[model samples]
Target: MRRDTRNRLLEAAEGEFTAHGYPRTTVTRIAASAGVSVQTLYLAWGSKRELLRGYLESALAGDAASPEDAITRFTGLSPRERLVELADLVGEIAERAATGWRLYRDASAVDPDIAADWDELQLLRHRLIARVFEDIPATALADGLTPKAAVDTAWTIASPDSHDLLVRRLGYAPGEFRDWMARTLTAAVLAPDSGADTTM
Candidate 1:
């Protein structure tokens, strides 16, 4: 099917980008790796940049659920539980995509288009984090912290860059990094006595 072919190409592209990086990866190489013609690859995604964008977008779009279901789930969780959930979820995503992100960072420097896309993805990520904590009461947030500031703190802690530094560079186990994030968010953002302060 058309969808199957596209997915295959995207999957193959991920490996190519991961191994050779964006600048060094080639259409011919990707097509060969995917067992498809170069023309077929181009027809599916237009350009290598578009292919990379598609791959990154798909990979970054975590755990899909309907809006109603997501709201129900978040509302069911206590404030502290929410932070823990976010920490675990973001940690898993970062662990999976950190290497690919390194490639994106390297590619963005010479490619304005990729740089723009990366910026947009970061904004989208921030917006998603805000939505995750939408059900938590404002009083649960740290003293003097605006909702925007709280979200920023959470975003920074959950960021791929933070994961790369703490886990990839410092060799912290994935679970250790996740626990650190939950604890950090609890101390920095959550009110002192909020149930979300479960220690790591």
Candidate 2:
């Protein structure tokens, strides 16, 4: 029952944060939406910042395993296949965490409390792409770009912001966006003459 209440509060908080953004969402609004008292919310999460953290954590708890496990899973794929797999994986993550990501990113500029989390999230994202880059063969990378540079490029193109621009703003369907990511990564980051093109 206690866990259920906590989940309800988190759900309400996520909805509030998504709708009004973190700066405008308040504990009272979340509490009322959750059908719980403000005190209950406070007891469960300590502060609105904590609630936001909880929401982000829950959103990121997708089907992925630990970093070690992910590395092991990617180890067997060929370089081109790894890039494709990484694009698919990153797309799924961005899709799941898009709401929280936007909320934290928007709030981080003015909210000192959210800034740290936002920075940490960005670091985590880069690290995930770095791991994928580690699996890619050195020969597969575009000329004149180091592994670090390649990883940075992959992170930028695969980001939720780009996904939102293409899918949400330009009206590309989710599958088309995913396909575009894989193709773009292949052409832009992989070896020259790889035959991958941005046709979609």
Candidate 2 structure quality by residue, lDDT tens digits, 60-174: 7665554445565566677677778887776776677878877877888988868988888778888878987775656668998788889999988888788778877899877
RMSD of each: 3.1, 3.9
Model 1 over residues 63-167: C-alpha lDDT tens digits?
554323333445567788888888877777776678767777778898999899888878878887888877777888888988889999998888888888898
Assess candidate 2 and give its lDDT.
Answer: 0.81
Worst 10 residues of 1 by lDDT: 64-73
Model 1 CA lDDT for position 124: 78
| lDDT (CA) per prediction | 0.81, 0.81
User: Which residue pairs in candidate 1 collide?
Assistant: 80-196
Candidate 2's TM-score: 0.89
lDDT of 2 at 84: 83
